[model samples]
Target: MAEELQTATDKLEDEHYPAYTMGRAAEMLGTTPGFLRSLDEVKLLVPQRSRGGHRRYSRYQLRLATRVRALVDEGTGLEAACRIVILEDQLEEARRINAEHSSHQPER
Candidate 1:
């Protein structure tokens, strides 16, 4: 029982865990459910679905949503904002990979 409880607690710390329901996620982002749904429509941040088929979001998804929200607030179009976020994510990943590769290279 203690192990189960610990595992549940550990999941909460996981950034990829689908811990927040749509409504809660929207509320956290200061947006409406419709906005989140729009994100899914645009194929930006497709959240996980619960057993009953309700959308559930992870902390990483919320971070992406927050970036989109900021862009939209700054007068960017929804589709453009999603594109920018995708590019940004890709660039970050590429940079991470490059850094890791550099660290493993032998000295000149």
Candidate 2:
């Protein structure tokens, strides 16, 4: 029973990790595969490459793509939207790093 519980917990943890192929990501985001590839071409959202050179979109990338779509629908130009998304992501990452660093600092 303990082993079964551990397995279930592991599976849930894995699900929390980002991992997805371009096709699957497209289906989930209500976009086409070509659209994703175009995003890559325009430097909007680049996916990771597999051993075979196929594009693989992680959950993070998919969420960013969705944001891009939303911005576009809201009257933002594609290039501007992409730039905004990149900047926002960078800001979020910096915040996370800063928080982690502060948390690990030695007590005065």
Lowest summed lDDT over 10 consecutive residues: which window, candidate 1? Answer: 42-51
Residues 1-108 of candidate 1 have per-residue lDDT tens digits of: 999999999999999999999999999999999999999999998899999999999999999999999999999999999999999999999999999999999999
RMSD (CA, angstroms), candidate 1: 1.2
Provide TM-scores for the models: 0.93, 0.72
Candidate 1, lDDT over the whole model: 0.97
Clashes per model (N, Cα, C within 3 A): 0, 0
TM-score of candidate 1 versus the correct structure, residues matched by position: 0.93
By TM-score, the best candidate is 1
Clashing pairs in 2: none
Q: Rate the local accuracy (lDDT) of all candidates.
A: 0.97, 0.82
Candidate 2 per-residue lDDT over residues 5-66, each given as its tens digit: 99877754663344678888889989889878878988977677889888887667787899
The parts of candidate 2 lying over 4 Å away from their true place are 1-18, 51-53, 106-108
Error of 2 at 90 (Å): 0.5
